[model samples]
Target: MARHIYACPLRWSDMDAFGHVNNVVFLRYLEEARIDFMFTQAAEAGAGEFAGGSVVARHEIDYRRPLVHRPEPVTVETRVTRIGGASLTVAYEIKDTAADGTETVYVQASTVVVPYDLAEGRPRRISPVEREFLSRFMDEEVVAV
Candidate 1:
């Protein structure tokens, strides 16, 4: 399986009173990674399949460690874990890289996204092309959060 990686910058406001990234801010990181994968990478791979926007039906996240403010960007790696008829599951891992190149995982997350047709006001099935595109990043093994 192939994982799409996005480098998300840390903002000063993301830190909380404890001097670490707030729990709520982790969702933003996952959202950024998902948007980059679906709207940017997948769209560029091919269009017309995912013309309509997707909605998050569910989100699951597990925090392994607190992320402190850092000069370097945090890495978010996303991959398709399951592809259903109208919904797909995306798994994510948030990590902070150290100066020596080591990485510390901060969180593990997943989101269930449903493709929707705004004009029709309903969820739509995954087209063959879209399925193929998603398959490129599909992981056979389940995420071990």
Candidate 2:
């Protein structure tokens, strides 16, 4: 399985008055993880490099639990679930791996990212390098528990 892991140190500002991470913060975390993953692939595989910019076309998140900001490290697992002609779908699982296992899922999310020619402001095809990098994580069967 192609898995991209990003450990984020929770910020004090990420917490809400309710004593847990605000719902919106989770998406930011996922986005960070996706960036880390793709960049890592670019460095390793030497192909499928995404030199272009990305835009989110769709997002779906399922919040499974609330986690308090402990200023600790949290892991976000990102994978490419699908790649379309002009878009890529990234799925993420956020968990407090320090406190619990994958069973302690804090949040689950999927984002559809489309390539954009920044200068032209138009949709573009996935570059050969990017497509190669994303192929490793395409529509896998093993679900994160």
Candidate 3:
């Protein structure tokens, strides 16, 4: 599967008093990558259909290591793990780059997102075009920590 990579800049505020990234901030990183993948990589029409068309139904995250505040960018890799009738699972890995150029994974996460219709106030089926665009990132194997 093709993973969409996003370079996430770590903010000082993202760290806690322990000098490592706060656990809650990891969710933000995942959200950024998900938005970038869906809105930027997907087609314009498909992207439009996604506007307020999805909601995170669940989030499962495993923190492997602590991430310290750094000037270098962190990398977030995102891919579609499963696509169902009304929802899809997006897997993510947040990694920090070291001076030696090694990447250490800090977190592994997955989010179940359901396509929603605001006007009708309910879940909606994934459109064919949207599925086609999302298939580009589909992976047969599940991503785990």
RMSD of each: 3.5, 4.3, 3.7
Query: Which predicted model would earn the best lDDT?
Result: 1
Residue pairs with colliding backbones in model 1 are none
lDDT of 2 by residue, 88-137 (tens): 88888898664343357889899988888888888888766667677777
Question: Which candidate number would show the highest TM-score if scored against the true structure?
Answer: 1
Q: Give the per-residue Cα lDDT of candidate 1 at 69.
A: 85
Candidate order by lDDT, decreasing, is 1, 3, 2
Per-residue CA lDDT of model 1 for 43-106, tens digit only, reads 8988444546788999999999998887888999898998888888998899967889897899
Between candidates 1 and 3, the one scoring higher on lDDT is: 1
- lDDT per residue (tens digit) for residues 74-103 in model 3: 899888988888888988999866889887
Q: Could you arrange the candidates by TM-score from highest to lowest?
A: 1, 3, 2
Return the TM-score for candidate 1, rounded to 2 decimals. 0.89
After the best TM-score superposition of candidate 3, give how far the Cα of residue 70 lies from its true spot, in angstroms: 1.3
Q: How does model 2 score by TM-score?
A: 0.85
For model 2, the superposed segments whose C-alpha errors exceed 4 Å read: 40-44, 47-51, 98-102, 141-145
Q: What is the lDDT of residue 109 in candidate 3?
A: 95
